[model samples]
Target: MFDFIRNHKRLMLILLALLIVPGLGLVGVQGFRGFFDNGANVAEVSGSKITRQEYDALLKEQLERMREMFGGAVNTAAVDTPVLRQILLDSLIQQRILADEAKRQRLSASDEAVRKTILEIPALGALRKSDGSIDTEKYHDLLAKQGMTPEQFDARVRRSLAIAQIGDSIEASALAPKSSAAQLAQLSMQQREMRELVLHPLDYSAEVKPTEEQLKQYYDTHQKEFETPETATISYAILSAEILAASITPSEEELKKAYQDNLATYQTAKQVRASHILIATPKADTVASAKAKAEALLAQLRKQPGQFAEMARNESQDPGSAARGGDLGYFAAGMMVKPFEEAAFKLKPNEISGLVQSDFGYHIIKVTEIKPAQTRPLSEVKQTLLSDLKKQQATQRFAAAADQFSNLVYEQTNSLTPAAEKFNLVVQTATVARQAMPAPTAVPALANPQFLAAVFESETLKGKHNTAAIEVGDNTLIAAHVTAHKPASVLPFETVKQGVQQKVTLLQAAELTRKAGEEKLASLQQSKSTAGFSPVIKLSRAGARGLTPAAVSAIFKADAEQLPQYVSAILDGGVYAIYRVESLSPLPELEPQRLTALQQQLAQLTGQLELNAYLASLRARSKVKIYATENAAASE
Candidate 1:
C-alpha cells in the first residue's frame, strides 16, 4: 500500500484532500482571516486537521522523491502552490476515508505487526552489527541526524503501518470469478485471417468534374470556411530578468564583506574514515536475541582487532560497504549516525572503537583517518557573490521602471516611444494571432491575464495608450502597445469545399466497403467457399490485428479447419469477410513462472477493478461540491 501510494502519489493526494482550501466563505467561517491563514489550514476532513506545515513538509519530501525518480530532469519550480495544494488535499481525503472505514470495521494494526513492519524498513536497518542486533547508540544517532526523536519516529512508523494494514485488508478481499478470467483469456487468444483490397476515391477524380453552376452552388453554401481569422500586431516593452541582471553591478567591497559574513558556508568540514561489521534482525521484537549475537561478535572483535576487515567482509549485512571490507569512506562530522559520528570523530587515526549500537544492529568502527576543516578563499567565490548582489539591485531597478512604464502607458495615454526614451528600452513587436501563446522570449508578463486583456481592449487597439507594465519574474517587467488589430470574421466557402468533399467520399467508401463485405460473407456462407464472389476476391491467411476481439474469438472458436466457413468482422478502417480458417493449433503449456505471473496479474487486475467500482459507488453516493470559479479567482 505504501508502495502504491508512492507510485501514484498525485492520484492518492487528490483522493485524500489534505491541502486545498475549498472556498473563501468556508475558510472565513472556519476562522481563517486571510490568505496565509486559509492556506495554512491544509484541510479539515471530518474533525481531523492537516496543517499547512505538515502538508508543506510532505510536499517537499514528495518533490525530492520525484526529483530522484526522474534523475533530476524535472524543474522543481514547476510543482507550484496550486499543484502542491491539490496533492496534499487529495492525500488527506484518502487518509480520512481509509481511517473512517478502518474504524468502522474495527481493523487496526497490532503492536507486533507494526514492529515487524518497522524492522523491515531499510532506512532503519542500516545501522546493525555483524551479530544481528539493534545498535542503540547508532539508532539514537540516526534519529538525531534526521532531526526526529525516537518516540516520534516510532509513532510515525506505527501510523504508517496501521494505514497500510487497512489498505491491505481492502485489497485482499477483492476477487474476480474464474469464468471471467477464462473469458478474457479466450478473447485475448482469438485470431482472424482475411484479405482486403482498397479502392481509392481519387481513382474516380476524373469522373467528378462538375459544371460551373454546381461549383458556384457548393461555394455559396460553404462560404464561411474560406474566410481568414482576425489577427493583431502589437508593440511591447520587454523587461526581462536576464536584461536586468546584465544592467546591475556590485562593488568589490560588497562581495568581500558578503563572503566574510557567511564564512562557515565557504569552509569545508573535517571528515573521518571508518569501517564496521553488521548483522540484521528481521523483526524489532527479536532485538534481545540480536543483541546477544552482537555481543558474541563483539568479543571476537576485541580478541582480534586485525581480523576486523575479514570479519566485516564475511559477516556484514550491509551489501553496500560489506564487499569493500565494510569501509565507509571519509564522511564529515554530521554525516554518520549520531553515535557512530561521535565515536568516529573522537577517535584518533588507527584507533578502533568497541561495539557500537544503532537502529539496524551493532557495529565496531575503526577510524582510518581524519582531515582538518579548511576555509575557502574569497577569490574562489567572488563571481557568485557578485551575481547574487546584481540580482538584488536589478530587482529594485526593475520595480521602479515598471511603475513609471505603467503610468506612462495608462495615465499619459502616450506612445511607447516616451517610456522607451526615458528608460533606454527598445520597442518590440509580436507576430501573435488572437489565440494565446507564449512569446518568443518566454516572458511571463506577455502570457499574463492583464497583458492579454489589454491586447483585446478597444482603447489599446484604437492607438490610445491603455496598457500597463506587468511583472514577469523577480527582475522582469513588460510594457505593451497595441500596434494593429482585426475584428473577428467568419471564413469563406471555397477553402472548405475540398475538406467537405473528402469527408463525403470517406463516408461513401465506408458504406460501400461494408455493403461489399456483407454480400461476400453471405455468398461464401451459402457456398462454404468463395466460389461465386465478384471483383476476383482473394483469400489471404493472417492473424487479427485490428478486428474486435469478440469477432475474432467467434471466428477462431468455429471448427474452421474441419469445414471451410465465412466470418465477417468490423475493423477500424473497414469491414472484413474472412472466407476460411486454414488451420488450428493448441498453444504450448504455460511455464511455472509464466503461470505464476499470469495469476498475479489477474489478481491485481481484479483488485483494481473492485477498487475502482467501490470508488465510483462512493462518488455516486457522496455529495461532491466544486467551487471552481471561486478557486480560479483565488489563484488569479
Candidate 2:
C-alpha cells in the first residue's frame, strides 16, 4: 500500500483511483498497541483517523492486483512480510499528509463534480433510472453496506478529486529543457571500438602446484568452508484439512437436503441449436441493399432446406460460421440481439425464418434442434453436489477442529498425543539437515520461515516447549517439538585434505591470472597501436557484442579523457580479460520519436522531483503524527 510513496509522481495518482482513498495501505490493527484506543490508526490527517480497517482492505486489494498482474504466479505466503507492510503504511501516511495540505491550500471540488464522479462508479451507477440519474435509495444503500454515510462518502469523493486536480496541474507544468534531451541521448548512445585478450585459469593451472604447508594453511584459514551443518529431528502433530475432509461422511439426508437447496442452479434454460445465412452490409453497399440480398438468399433456402448450408457458404457474409453452414450452436434467450432473437425463437425444429435484421445486418436462421427448459434430476448432478457439499462441510468443521488442535497442543506443552488423538491425527516425525539443507519447500509444515525459526529457538529446542501453531498455507496449521539437535562442527583437516589442496591451487592460479592481466593492460596503454592485440570494433553503451553486463560496466567506467584506454577484470571461472578503448563516438542527432520519448522521460523526472520536494515541505510544516509503525507492530 505505502510502496508507492517512493514514487512521488504516481503517489497522488494512485490514491485518487481507489478511495476513500482505498489505496491507503497499512497500519497493523491486529497486534498494534497505541496511545489511542486500539491503536488501529497510523496517523490523523486534519483530525481524520486513517483506520486499520481501511489500511487492511486497500493492502489486500493491491496484493491481489499484484498477484493478478503476475498471472497468479506469486506465492502469497512468501511475500506477506513486515517490510512490505511498512511500505504500505508510509504510502497511506503520505496520502494523508498531501490531503491535509490540499485542505490548507483551499483546494475544493464542487458538489456537482462530486456527484458526477459518484454516479460514474458502477456500484453506484448500476441502479440508474430512465432519466440517466442515479437511484438515490440504492446509492445510499450502497454506501451503508460499505459502512459510510452520505456526507462521509461525499466528502471523500470531493477531497480525492481536488487532490487529483492539483496533482495533474503540477505534473503538466513540469518542463524539460531542449538541451538536456540531446545531452542524454549522447550519454546513452556513446560507443567504443576495442579488442580484448581473454585468459583462462587452465592456462596458469599447469604452472602452479600447492605444497603441503600451503594446503594446511588454506584449510585452517577457510575452516568455515568445511564446517558440517547442524541437523535437527522434529516431531509434529499434523492437523490436515484435506485428510479431515476426506474422512468425514455426511449422512444421506444432509446430502439430499443440500441438493434440493441448490436445485434452482441445476435448472437449464430453453435454447435452440441454430445455423444462420447472413448477408452482411458490404463496404461498398448500403444496409437496404444488404437486407434485399438477405431476402433473396432466404427465399432460396425456403425452396430447398438441404441446400441451406451450401447457400450459406456461397453467399452468407458471416465468415466465422459460413464454412460450417453458419452454425451458431446452442444459445439461450438474451444471447442474441432483439430482432434476430424474436425471429429465431418463434421457429420450430426443421423450420426456417425469413430475413431477420440486427446490428450485424440481415440473417436467415434455421432451428436445427430445440431444448425446452427443464430441471436436472439428482441422478445427473449427484457427484458434483456431493463434492461441493463435502468441501463446505469440511471447511466448517476445520474451524472448530483447528481451535481444539491449537489449544490441546498448547495445554499439554510436552507431548502431541492428546491433540493427535482428539483430531485423529498422527504425530509424524522427520530429520532435517541444518536450516538451509532441507529446503523449506521440501517439508510442508516448515514452509513458513517463522516456523523454521521457532523450531530452532531456545524455547522449543532447549526448554522443550511445543512451538505455537504457525500457519503455513491456506487452512493449514502446524506445531512441532525438537526431538534432537546436532550442533554445527568443522570437518577435521584429514577429512577434507584433497578438497583443501584443490582450493589452494585454484586461489594461486586466480592470483597469477590477475597479475598477468594487469601487466598486459599496462603494456597496451603504452602502445596506442594494436601491436599484440586482436582486431577491435565498436561496442555501444547498449552493448551489442555479446559482452557480459559486468564487462560493459567496466568498459564505461574507465577514464574517458585518454584515447586507447586499458582496463582488466576477473571474469567467470577464474578467467581474466583486458578491454582497451580505441575511440568514442556520440550520436549525430535525436530523431523526432526519440526526442518525444526523452521529453516525456524528462517531464516525469521533473514531476517526481517537484512532488517529492512539495511532500517534504508539507512534512516539515505539518503536525504529522504516527501512532505506530509497521516494524513496531510486527515485533509483537
Candidate 3:
C-alpha cells in the first residue's frame, strides 16, 4: 500500500485531470449545449458532450507534455497525426465512460478517505501545515494554478478515487499462475550462441555505377527533396519574462523575507541508510502468522547479528532491495511510511530494531549510517534568492504586459515598432520560412509553429503588416511584420545531379549487399559452413551485447531448436548481416531478486491485460458517439 509514496508528480497531475477539470466542463456544459449538437461535438458519453474545442485543447496539452518528456526533441509533425488524434479522442471517451460508470454505481469516496489520501500523497506534502492539517490557503493556491476551486478539486479527487476502485478490483482479481510466470521467465533467459558474417555496402559499391539517366529519374521522382522552401524576411518583436526580469530590482529586505518564507526549500533534512528484512502481510496471510514469522526472524537475528544479510537475502519479500541483502539505500525523513520511519530514526548505527509494524508488513531494520541535517546561510544563497525574486516579479509584470502587447500589435497592424517601443524590445529582423531550417543562426522563436503560422498568414503577407501576437514560450510573445517573400521552387536536375548520383549508388549498393547476404545464408544452410563467420558469442533477450535489437530478434527468431540455423538481418547504415546459430542453452537458476522482479512483472502484465479487457467491456455496454470522420466508437 505504501507503494503510492513512490508515485511520480506527473502522474498526480494526470490523476487530478481524471475526467477534465470540473470548472471547464461546468462552463462548457452550461453555455455550449446548443453548439454541441451541431458545430464542435467530438464525442459524447451518456448526456455529457466532448466538445471539439476541448479535444483540441487536450491534444495541445498532450503534445506539450510529449515535448517536455523528450526534452523538446520530439517532432511535432510526427506526433500530431490523424492516428494520434483518434487515439486521444478514444482515450477521452473512455475517461468519460469511467466517470459515468462511477456515478451510476454510486462509487463516491468517503470524506475521510479523501482527506487521508490527500495527506498521504508525497507530491502534495508542501500543502500540509505544520499542525498536520491541510494548509487551506496553499491548497487554494495550488488548485487555482490548475484553474480549479477547492470544491472542484475535491470532487475530482473523489471521482478519481472512485474510478481507481474499478481498476483496483480488476487488478486484485488478476492472477499470474506460478507455472506461467516461470515459463515466461525461462524463455526470456534462454540463450543462443551465434556467429555473424556481414556484407558491407562499400564492398559492392564498385559493382554498381549510376548513370545520368538513373540520377535524373531518381531526382524526378523526389523533386520535393530538391525544392527550396518558401522564405520571408520579417521584422519581429519579442516580449519575454527574462527581458522583464532584467529591468526589476529587489530590495535587500524583500530578498530576506522571500528567503525566510521558503526556508524549508533550502534546508537539507537528516538522512538514514538502512537495511530491512520484511515479512509481507498479503491478504492470504493472517496477521498473527505474519507477525509470528517476523518475531521468529528477529529472535534469530538477536542471537546472531552477523547473519542479518544472509537471513534478509533468504527471507525478505521486497523485490526491489532483496538482492542487495535488503539494503534500502539512503532515504530522508518523510520518504518512508510513518511507523517504519519512526522506528528507523530511533536506532543508532549498527543497531538493530525489533519488528516494526507497517502498512506493508513487519520490518526489522538495521541502521548503517546517518547524515546530519544542514541549513545554508542566507549569505550563501543570496544570489539565488535575488534571481528568483526578480523572476517572480517579472512573471507578474509579464501577465499584465502580455495583454497590452497583444492589443498594440493587433491595433497597429502596420509595424511592430510601436509595441517594441512600448515594451523596450528591439524590432529584430530575420529570414525565415514556414518551417524553420536547422541552422546555428536560426531564430528560436521563429521555429514555433504558431509564430510561423502568423508570420505566413495571407493577410499579414499581402499587406506587409504585423501578425497578431503569439505565445512562443513561457511568458514570451512574438509578433512579426513581413517585409519580403519568396515562393517555393524546385532546383534544376543539373544543380543536384551529384547528390542524386550518390543517393542512387547507395540504394543500389544496399540492395546488392542484401542479395549477397541472402545468398550467403542459403549457402550456410545447405553446406553447414562456418568459414566466413566471426567467433561465437552468446546472446539473450536480457543481454544483446552490442548488437541492435533487430539483429538480436532475427537471431532468436531463427529455428534454434535445431543446431546450425542461419538468419539474415538488414541493418541500418546499409549493412547486411548473416548469422549462424551454433547452440542454445537455458540460463542457470536466476538470482533471488531477479526472480522476484520477473514474477512481479508477469503479474503486472496479467493485471494490465485484465484491465484492458474490462475497459473494452465497459465501452461495449455504454453508449459512446464520435462525431469525427473516423467515428471510433461505431467500430467498437
Candidate 4:
C-alpha cells in the first residue's frame, strides 16, 4: 500500500490536498471554496465557517467513538438525537473562535513545542518509536484519515494552549475575601438550642369524618384521578434470528469451505521484536548535522555491540524508551511506518543496520528476534467457523422469510392467525395501554413502547387490521393485531367512594392540627411557660438521626427578633412540629481544618464567577452565526 504512495508521490499529495484542504485553509483555499459556498454551513465563527460537511463528519466520528467506548451499552437512539448534533456544532464553533483570537493576539507555538505537545497527548503517544519520539510519518497518516493536515493540527494545538492561558489568568485573579470566608464558616458551624411540639395527623382523623354529599361532590369534580386510559388486547407473531439459527446445522464440508474461502484471517503475520535508540531531529536540526551526529554514534555501536544497551541508556534522545534502555516490545509489520518497518524486518537476529535515513532523521537500528509466520489448522477453529456459517445461513433465510411475514399480516388484515400458521410462530396476546412511554436509554423492546404505538394506531385502535412488521431490535420484527379495543372511561363512583371519604377526613384533620398548634404557640409565648413542651437540647445544623434536613432549615428560619421565638412547619410522615428558639448564641471560631475547607469552597465559587464572566465576554465579542437553513438540512 505504501509503495504506491512512494511511487506516485505527486498523486498522493493531490489526494491529501483534496481531502484535507477544506479544514486547514477553509476560507482561503479557492479549490474547496465553491463546495462550501454553494452548500449550506451549520455555523461560522469570526471569518471561519464550519460547513455542513465538516459538522456531519465530526458527529460521525464522535458517534463511532462512543460506540467503541460503550460497546453493547451504547444507546444509538439517544446518542443520535438533535441535542448531540447541536453540542458538536457548538464545540467546533468554540474552537474556531479561540483559534481566531489566538491569531489576532499573535500567539504562536514553535515547531518544537508542537512536537512536544503531540507526544504528550495520549492518542498520539501510541505512534511513538522505541526511543519515545513520535513517528512523524504515522502521525501524518493519522491526520489524513481524520480530514486534517499537520498544519491544521498544529494550529489547533496552539489555540488550545492559548485558551488554557486565559483560563489560568482568570483563576489566578480570583481571590475570596477573608471576612466573607469567616462569615460562611460561622453560618456552617452555628448550632441551635430548641424544642418541638409534634402533632400527629391521625389524632384528628376520627373527629372529622365527611358526609355522603361531600363524597359524591369530590368524585364528580376529580373524575380524572379515577379514570382509566384507553387500552387494547392484541395478538402478535414474531420471527427471531436466534431461533432460526438454532434450527439449521452446518455440515463439516460447509465449515471447511468457509475456512478455506477466508484463509487469510486464519493466519497470523510475521512479528518482529526489536529495540532502538533514536537521535532526535524533528525539523529542528539540519539533515547534514543530524546525519553526522547519528553516524558518529553508529561507529561506537559497531565497535562494541555488547555495550548497545549502556550506550543507549546514556545517549538516546527518546524520552519514552531511554529509561528502559530503548526496549520496544513486540510489534507487527504494518504497526510501524513503512521506512522503519522495512529496515527492521530486513536484518537477521542481533544484526545491526548501518545509518538509515527516514522522516524523523537517520537512525542505527539493531535487529532482535523474529517470529516466523503462522496459520491455525481447521480443527482448532472449527467450532467458531461453524457458528458463523449457521448465522450467515440463518440471516439469508430470515430476510426472505421476513418479506412474506410482512405481506401475510397486511394481506390477511383481520388477524395474525395466517402469518403465525405460515411461519409456525406462536400467536402471542397482550393487553396494553395507549401511551407509548419512552425508555430513553434502553434498547427498543417488544412490549414497552413500539408495541404500545402499534396497538394504538388509528385503524388498529378501531379494530380495522393488524400492524405491519415493526423492527424493534436487531434481526427482530413484530406484527400486532388489536382483537379488542376499549376507549377511556371513568370508574363507577360506588367503587372508589370509601377511599375518597378517607382522604377527605385526613385533609380536614391536617387543617385542625395547624390551627391548634398556632393557637397553643401564641398562648405559650405570652405566658412564658413550658406547660407541655418536649425536653430541649443544643444541636448543630446536622440534626439527630430522626430529624430531617428540611426540619433543621425551618428551625433556623424561625422568627428570632425576640426571646422564645416560635415557628412551625409540616415534617415528613404527616406530622407538624412547632419549634421554639429559647435563646441565641454568639458566633465562635471554627477549627483549623473547617476554616480551611470553608475558604477553599469560597475560592472555588469566586473562580467559577470569573470563568463565566470571561466566557460571556468571548461570546459577546465573537460574530457567531448558526444558519437555520443548514441546521434544518442536517435534521432532514
Candidate 5:
C-alpha cells in the first residue's frame, strides 16, 4: 500500500485536486490547503490526497458517527486526542491498502451504477409528487438550503461510491458459511439445571486444631494479605451535583411566566380516539395524482364517516396501525405531523375533519372528545420555584469565590489557611488510599489533569508548595496541599498470619473432599449397590435442583459410573454441595424463525471478521512509523 501510494503520489494529488476544486466554492478549501505542509505526508494514492486536514476531517466525522450510534450519551472528556489520531491514521492506511488493491484488480463502477446509487440515497432523493417523476424544483430548493450545487453534490457522491465499491469487493471475498450460525445458536441455547449443597472448612475447625509451629509457619508465609492497603491522607473540596442544583435560585416573576407559558405542556390534552381509512396517492411525486387521491378520499369520508375504521382495516398501507382498525388512540398537540396536528386540534367533539395532507400521505381525523387543559396555581409550584432559586444563587456564589480561592491558595505557598480564611470554607482532610483519593463522583474540574499530575509529583507531597487550583466542574474550583505522605512498602509477616492460615485450611478441605467423593463414586460404580454405605443417597434423574456454578462443577467431576457420588465444595453462604447426573437430554431442533435469524447473524459476523482480517493485513504490510514521544510533546 505504501509503495503504491508513493509511486502514484502525483497522480493521486491531481485526481484529488480535480474532484474537490468544484466543491471548494461551497466548502472553502482554505482550511485544508496547508494540512500536509508540516506533517509527513503518509500516502497519496490513485489521485487521492490523504493530507492531515483530510484525515482530521474524517476523524471528526467518525466521532460524530460514534455520537449518533450511542444516541449522544458519550462523554466528550473520554475522547483522547492520541486515541483519535491513531484511529484516523489506521483508517487512512486501510483505505490506501484497499484503493491499491482495487486499482490492481481493475475494479470499477459504471457511470450509470454510480448515478443510480446516488439517486437512491434518501438525502439526495427528490421530493415525491403525485407522479413518480423527480420533483426538480424541490430538489433544487433542498440543495440551496444545504448551500450546495448539484454538480458538487454529485461529485461528493461519486467519491463516496468509489470508496464503497472498493470496500464491497474486499468484503464480498471474505464471506463465510452459514453453518456457523447453527453452532452459535447451540452454544447460546445450552443451559444446565442442577441442585447444590455447600460445605465450609471453618465448620470443622473445632475438631482439628493446628500446632503452634504450623500457625507460626503459616503467618510467616503470607503477610501481605492481612496488612492494610497503602493509604493516603488527602485534602479535597467536593462539588456535588445535588449541591449545584440546590444553588440555583429563580426569580418569582421568572417562575410565574415560565409556568404560564408552559401550562399546556403541564396539562394532558384531551385525546380523540379514532380510526381512519386512507387512500394514498399512487405516486406522491406528481401534484395531479396526489390531488386526485385526496379528492377521492374526501368524497368517501364525506359520504360515510361510520365506515372509516372498516375501510382503514381493509385498505390502509400502514400495516402496523391497520391491524388495530387504524386506531391512533388519543393523541394531543405535537403528537402528529403539522397538517395532522392542525386538523386534529381544530376539530370539535365528535367532529370529523376533511382530508388532510401529511408527509405519510392523506389523513381523515375524527375527534372523540374535547379535553380542557388543566392548570395549577402559583402556590402549588412555590416550593419548586424556591429550590430552583437557591440553586442559581449557589452557582453564582461559587463562581464568584472560585478565582479568589484559587489565588489565595497559591499565594499561601504551603498552606490552605489563606483560602480557608478568605472564603470561610472548611479545610477538610481524607484518609483515603492514593488510588481512591479522588472520590468516584468528584467534580471533573476539581480533579483536572493539573491537580492529578500534581498529586503524583514528589515536590507536592513534600509540602514544598500548594498545588494549583483545578476546575472540577461548572462554577467549582479546588486546590490542595498534602499534609502527610506514606511511601509504598511491603507489609511485615506478622500482619498477614490469620489470612494465610485461612487460605491453607480452605485448600486442605478441598483436597479432602475431592478424594472422599472420588472414593465414594468408585465404590458405587463397582458395587452397584448401597448395602455397605452408611446412608444410601438417592439421585434424581434431572440431577440436583438450583445448582450454582461452583457446586455443579464439583459434582460433575465425581466418577459418573459410581452411584451415590458425593462431592462437597464451598458454595455461597459457607456451604458445600455434591451431585450426580442421573440422565442426559439432547436439545430440541431449531424453530424456523430462529434458524433464519441465526443465519442472518452468521452472515453479519462473517462480514465483520473479514473486515478485521483485512485491517490486520494492511497493518502488517504497511511501513508505519510512529514517533510517540514527538507526538506526545506536540500534544502537551
Candidate 6:
C-alpha cells in the first residue's frame, strides 16, 4: 500500500484540489465564510457588519467610564443588562450609519482640526508642555499604554469628527421661528395667582374602615411585595487592589519620581479679570479710524475711570461684552490674543493700559482682579503620591496573581478556602440574593451580576461548590462557595394582614378625599366664591409654590380665561386639593437678557428635533439588519 501511495502522490494531490475548489466557490471565499460563521457579528449596517468583538469592546469601554464616574459604587454587573446591551448595540449601529453617510458625502476632518480636538481633551492635559505644544514622547507613551499607535488614534479621532460634522451642519441650518419661541416663552413664564382648598386624607381617615375580606384580597393581589427573595448564605473571597496594596509600600525615591512626573497637576496658572473697550475695525472702518476711536475712549476713561462701563456699553464694538460693560471675565494667560494678553498681564491691579493693537483693533484695558500662580510643596502632596504609588505596584501584583486565583477556585471546587489562602484573602460570609443589594457601597463583589449569576448556577448551587472567579471591577476578582440556599417564598397572609389593612385604609381614604374635593370644586364653579380658600399664591413652571408636580400641572391646565376657574389634583399621602384660579398675568415683555436666553434655548430644541428627523431619514434610506446573539438583540 505504501508503494502504491508513493507512486500515486501527484494523482492524490490533483484529486484533493478538485474536491476543495467547489467548496471554496460555494462559500464565495473561505475567509468571508469564516467571518460570517465566527458567530460574533451582531449587526449589518449599509454594507458593513458590526461584530460581537466590537460590541464587547465598546461595552467594556463604557463600563470602565461608568466605573470611574461612580468609583466602586457603580454596579459593573448592571451595565451588562439586556437593556443596556441593546442601547449600546444601537449606538454602534447608528455610529456606523453616520460614518458611512459621512464617507458617502465626502465629508472629512483636516489634520489641523484633528490636532485641535486632540489637544482639547482634558485627559491629555498632563502631556502638554508649558508652551502649549504636546510632548511627543509622553504622547506616544500614553498611546502605547492603550495599545494604539499615534496614527491609529488620529485616524479614530478624524473619523469621529467627520461624523460629527453631519450633525453640526444639520443643527446650524435649524431655525426656530421668533413668534413660536415667543409663544412658548410666554407659556413657560406665565404666572397665575391661585389659592387652594386641600382635603386631607388624615381628616377623612376616621370615616373609612377596613374589613377582613379587603385585607385578604389585597394580600393575594400584591403577593410579590410580601415575598422574600431567593437568598444564599455564601462564603466569598475578594482579591482586590486595596487588599494587595496593604502589603506593598513605595520607597521615598519612587514617590518623588511620581510627583516630578505629574508636576504640572500640582500648580495653578495666573489669571486676571479685566474689562476692555474694543473699537473693532469692521468693514465700514479702517484700522486707523478704529484706533483713533479707541484712543478717544481711552482719553475719556483716563479722567473718569469709574465711567468706563458706560463708555464700553455705549461704544464698544464687541456685542458679547458690551451689555456687561465690556467685562471680559477672568481668563488665564493663554486665553486671549498675544498682544491683548501681554498688555493685560503687565498691568497691576486697577492699572489701565495704553492703546494695545490686535486683530480686533486697539483696546483700552483695565485690570480689576489678579489671581497669582500657586504651587503645592512636595511635603504637602507626599501622602497622595505615596498612595498612588502603592496602588500602581499593587495593580501589577494583582495581574500576576489573577490567573492563579482563578485556577485555585476551580481546581478546589468544594470551597473558597484554598483560593483565599493562596491569595492571602479573607473568606467573608454574607447572605446574597439574585438582585443586587440596595445599599450603594455594600458588598460590591456580591452585587456583581456575573458573580451572582455564577453563584446561582445549578451545579454550583446543588453540589455546594465554589463559583468560578469573576472580575467584578478593575483589579478586583471574586469567587464564592454556596453554604446554603433558600428558594423564594411568600409570607402567610395572616402574618401580613395588619400591613395590608393599612394599605387598604389609604386606598379608601384617597377615594373619599377625591370625592370630597371634586364636590367642592363643582360648588365653587357655580358659586364663583373664594370662601374657605387659602391666600392667593403665585404659580409658574419655575415656582411651583411647594405643590406636587401633578397638582401644579392640574392647576396650570385649568381654563383661566374666566376668573375663579376651578380644578382638582390628588397630592401625595392621599391628600386631595381644589384650586381656584384667580387671575392670569402674562409677562408683558421678557427682559432683554431673558429673551436672548429663551431664543437660544428654543433654537437648541429646534436643532435637536431636526437632528432626530435627519437621523430617521438616514435610517430609512439605509439598509440595517441586526443579528440575534446569546446576549441580546437590538430591534430593527
Q: What overall lDDT goes with each candidate model?
A: 0.60, 0.74, 0.79, 0.70, 0.56, 0.78
Per-residue C-alpha lDDT of model 6 across residues 142-209, encoded as one tens digit per residue: 88876678997777777777777777787677787777777888888899999888889878889988
Instruction: Please give, for residues 292-344, the per-residue lDDT of candidate 5 as tens digits.
Output: 76677667767887776776777676666787777777766645667777787
Shift in Å, residue 138, candidate 1? 18
Candidate 6, 348: how far from true, in Å? 27
Query: Model 2: what TM-score?
Result: 0.72
What TM-score, to 2 decimals, does candidate 6 have?
A: 0.70
lDDT of 1 by residue, 508-531 (tens): 566666766677667666866544
Global lDDT for candidate 1? 0.60
Q: What 10-residue stretch in candidate 2 is worst by lDDT?
A: 27-36
Model 2 residue pairs with clashes: 2-87, 2-88, 2-91, 18-22, 19-22
Supply every candidate's count of residue pairs whose N, Cα or C atoms clash at under 3 angstroms: 42, 5, 0, 0, 42, 0
Give TM-scores for every candidate, taking all chains together and pairing residue i with residue i.
0.62, 0.72, 0.67, 0.61, 0.53, 0.70
Point out the worst 10-residue segment of candidate 1 by lDDT: 23-32
Cα lDDT of model 3 overall?
0.79
RMSD of candidates 1 onward, in order: 8.6, 7.0, 10.8, 10.9, 11.1, 15.6
Instruction: Find the candidate with the highest lDDT and give its number.
Output: 3
At residue 402, what lDDT does model 5 achieve?
A: 65
- Cα TM-score of candidate 3: 0.67
TM-score of 4: 0.61
Q: Name the runs in model 6 displaced over 4 angstroms.
A: 1-38, 63-84, 115-134, 248-393, 625-635
- In model 3, which regions exceed 4 Å deviation? 1-43, 51-92, 127-153, 244-404, 436-443, 590-597, 616-636
* Higher-TM-score candidate of 1 and 3: 3
